[model samples]
Target chain A: MDINILLVDDEADFVETMVKRFGIRKMPIDSAKSGQEALTSLAAKDYDVIILDVRMPGMDGLETLKLIRARAPLTEVIMLTGHASLEAGMQGMNMGAYDYVLKPADFDDLLDKVRKAFERKQLNAKARKQGA
Target chain B: MPRPANRAPEPASDPHGDPKGILARATGARLWKDHSLLLWAHFLVPPVLAALVVAATFATPILAGILAAIVLGIAAVSARGLLSRLSQTEEARLALNTQLIQSQKLAAIGELSAGIAHEINNPIAIIAQEAEWAAHLIGEAEKGCSADFAEVKDSLREVRAQVDRCKNITHKLLDFARKREPVLQDVDVVRIIEDMARLVDKEASYKNVTLVRSLPQDLPKLRTDAPLLRQVVLNLMTNALHAVDTGGRIEVSALADDEALEICIKDNGCGIAPENIDKIFNPFFTTKPPGQGTGLGLSMCHTLVDGMKGKISVASKPGQGAAFTVRLPRRV
Candidate 1:
């Protein structure tokens, strides 16, 4: 399966830049502006992993994480936060997030985290198939 | 504003300065005695001075000079005693102010705890869902599947949930730590004051300070930030009640005069010293001793009132009682 991923954030320039970077590397990337939109995309498409931003105007990242866990348990979520509060990072980890990477994120670090989250999702899917 | 619950240092039972806790308790009695002594000496001295003058006029100069020395000695002794008594009164006032500071700090911590509870609740729900999903998914997996993946999922989810709970509570505790924000707002004075009084009433029930509202029903609203205004009202009312003996009364009233809305909270407490009337609103200035006050309540109030593009003034004469008047711009 092509490794599918969703990058959700409100910053247009940041999103476009990341999309271009991913495109150059031929990495699969889909993006959304808010938590609600991210959820809608997940419902229609089966992404292996998701990258979510915590602080947004509406339906913040934490709330989005809860909805995602409830509706699409198999998809792993990697949190992206511009504000580096240890408490937020800790909470993200506690909510079964693959990991929360801080911004201005080292693109290489995010890619590494994204790869790990995809592998975790793949493992879960394989287990589910075998169990079924 | 919410305050951190745990950050409130426990009732500093052994406050650094004094563990014995007795300073100027007999201030009134001492002052009365000093004044009585002064009166007696004044009465006795006048008669003696008259006798000395008469003696001098009648050619008994030596007798008159001896009388003059005695009168001067009496005046010096009484003056020293009065000054000492006054200093003691000043020290006692300082202690009461300290107690007020401690109370404000504890209040701040309680506010923080409430905010922390709100922050933690969501992550806990997510953690639970993730664990349940992992559990059932693993249960349905192949009998010979890699147990390592299963172990990682279970351990990580458990670790994450516990950490999230702690972080949520701590973050809230920090966020809600209430302190004086020098920011002012255009507030609806009548509404804000009433809201504050209502909160104080619920809390005052435990202290038994009877809260009386004497507000003009149709007074124009004032321009003030609701949150800061609410806090200033709360601190003053709470401070008044603390000084008021149980079964004492606190009156909260609002009125308007031309361009300003005037709100007053009057309490029949221990009252304030004439010297202290100016110091009460100074930061860290309190009449209540350590562990009871942070000395910031009135200071915070003073700052809030001033920042609102208005004025806050207090009127009191020791023993007659104290009244705080706050004026804010009338909302159009």
Candidate 2:
């Protein structure tokens, strides 16, 4: 698979490292510094999965998630947060994020979740097609 | 799995058997297994004793009378036993019927509330927007007016806040009512639980509560809807955190068997009262004072677990603590 992935975070260093890590795996990933920018990117291209940082400067992850879901209902979102805030995690999952991973997440674990999320998107798409 | 619409109908092996006939056969098999001896005695003993009674009547009246009395006594005893057994079965069926009716009522109420929530949401949104617009107009007028409109702005802010509160309740109601089909995927059960537990770690620490995880290392991966499971675990953990007092303890554990995977959240806190236990999972059922809780968390958990073809239950003793268990099938 050719998976279209987007990484949204405000931290420059975190975004840079993720881009490089995914690049080494032969998977080119898009990056966004804020939720607004993520929405812009989403409008331009259809993405299968999104790795979103919870705490951001402009639009928070949960708010961004609501919009992303509205814009692209099939896209899967995985929330990443630096701090373990119980409230945000609850809200994120309730709002339809695929999974929630804390900062310092194991690279392999994150990759596994991403793959699973992509698989769900494919299944959902196929299901919708059949339903239609 | 293949779509139901595309699948072929199953073949019935018996050419003469329709669906009803197959059902009757199944019931008959079960009845035979359970009461075969009773049936044999009931059919055979009566005829055999009647023949002996007739023979005795032909020979002597006294012996025939004795035999007839014995037969009558046995029949009376068996009739009494069967009557008691039938009454017991009737009582059990009545209880089950009540339960079924209660659940059906709950489902109907759930649907009605969801419809009300949906119909109310738009007006709530409009109210919030009008509040905002009114505040803006007041702000624009305040600039040109000589008098202070401070109190008016304050009231507008209050209206907006109250509107937001209504919005929150309606949104939760909508969530409770939404029919989300579970999307199955390969899920690492341990990883998902650990991730959600980490989210609760900081809050747990603040309350001096220890969140112990006893997840087994050999637990199997589950095929389930990942986010729905995540929501259930997170809500339950959060509920536990609220239940515990300072320096309290909460334990999160996961167990897997061949058939199902079980995750439990146990808390040492004020347990539910016996009177309130049955009402806990009902929507809008809350023990917390007004404005403290919306009471949708556990009910939402119930709804989500049901969507995933799983079961959720609670066991609690007042003054001791409470434990909630969520059991998911190995494959949904």
Candidate 3:
């Protein structure tokens, strides 16, 4: 099954590269420049996983995560950061982000985490359906 | 032996039915061993005294009357003793029941607040969006006409700031409510503690507080979730930093034994008040001035530690500083 994915980051170059990389892997992905834009995209579509950057221009990644979780609980989020801030990492994990990845993240590792997150989302959806 | 017609047959003959028999035998043996003297006294004393009273009554009336009075006195004393013991047991049970109810109540409150926080998030988001939109419209109007809308802009700013604060509280509430199942991996616990300590080092220095690390080089690696442990350790260290006074000292130490790994954060500052110590880990139980603290930090730490299958505890005296310890199993 195709895993609908969204990447949210403020850095234009980083988002561009990520989009191209995923495209090369035959997995087309959507991108958003900021938390506000991410929320707008989320409102329109159901994404299985989101690659969110911790540091954003307007609303930071942690704040964005809270809203995303509230809106789409089944959607898993993986936090991306340029610097290793322990504080941010703690907050991201506590806020229910699927995982935290440091910048200069290895492509293979990121792919592995994305696949894992997508699997969790699928399981969550199945569980909810069964519960209902 | 023939059983009575109204009596049920016994299961004691079946070998597989020996469980109940064994339990009964064990309990009977224990009772005999612990209270043999009392049991013997209860059976023998009453009849022996009755015989003696019968003999004395036949021989002399005064002797029989004195013996009967002594027996009555003994009975009264024993009855009082039994009554007091029964009340003590009742009191103990009541205390236990109260403790159980208190914990259950806290759990319910935690769940309710989480639900409320989740429901409140949507409205708070709309309010924030409307505030932002209003500010945007005001800016556009100013561009078209020469007008100073500084007061209006300031009010909008305050509105946005307040919304952000509300967002913070709700987000924390959601976090506290989040049920994170730990994904176990081999983790270097000492490294996690050191990393978190580094995060708090600059803040500690700014307050002239000394942050000490006493992690041993040979401490064993733990099998647990890394991020959750890191969150717990960092939160505790931050709390210790906040507790200490200027030029005070905070110590972060780790040690391991056969079964569990223990990390302690000790602070030498104004100690916890005796009355507030128990409530410190309760959500929304903060001593800080209004709007200064959400009081979720320690409680969140408590929840996280519990999720990791660890124990978190505090030892404090009113004037003698406080120490917080987290104990995690070597393999979890």
Candidate 2 lDDT by residue in tens digits, B174-284: 765777777888788898888888899999999999999999988988999989999999999999999999999999999988889999999999999999887788888
DockQ of every predicted complex: 0.02, 0.87, 0.15
What is the per-residue lDDT of model 1 for residues B168-260, given as tens digits with 9 covering 90 to 100?
A: 444433433433222323345665566456546645677677999987778765545544565567667777777788778899998888867
Off-target runs (Cα >4 Å) in candidate 2 are: B1-46, B49-95
| Angstrom error at residue A105, model 3 | 12
Chain B TM-score list for all models: 0.45, 0.77, 0.70
Question: Which consecutive 10 residues in model 2 chain A have the weakest lDDT in total?
Answer: A100-109
Off by over 4 Å in 1: A1-132, B1-186
CA deviation > 4 Å runs, candidate 3: A1-90, A96-132, B1-99, B140-147, B330-332
Q: Can you write out model 3's per-residue Cα lDDT over B1-332, one digit (the tens) per residue? A: 22122222222232222433434343333323465687577556766777888899999999999988877776666567557655665565565455445445555666777777778888999999999999999999999999999999999999999999999998788666766556666677887777567667767778899999998999998988666787788788878877888999999999999989999999997889999987888889988899988989888887788778777889999877899999998866
* Residue-level lDDT tens digits of model 2 in A12-84: 9999999999999999999999999999999999999999999998789999999999899999999999898
lDDT of 1 by residue, A1-132 (tens): 577989999999999999998888789599999999999999899888889999988999988987897798788888887765434543454455666566787888678667756766666677678868
CA displacement after TM-score superposition, residue B164 of candidate 2 (Å): 1.0
lDDT of 3 by residue, A1-132 (tens): 888999999889988999999999999999999999999999999999999999998899988998998899889899898876766876776667777677877888789778867876776677678768
TM-score of each: 0.35, 0.85, 0.61
Name the 10 consecutive residues with the lowest summed lDDT in model 1 chain B: B175-184
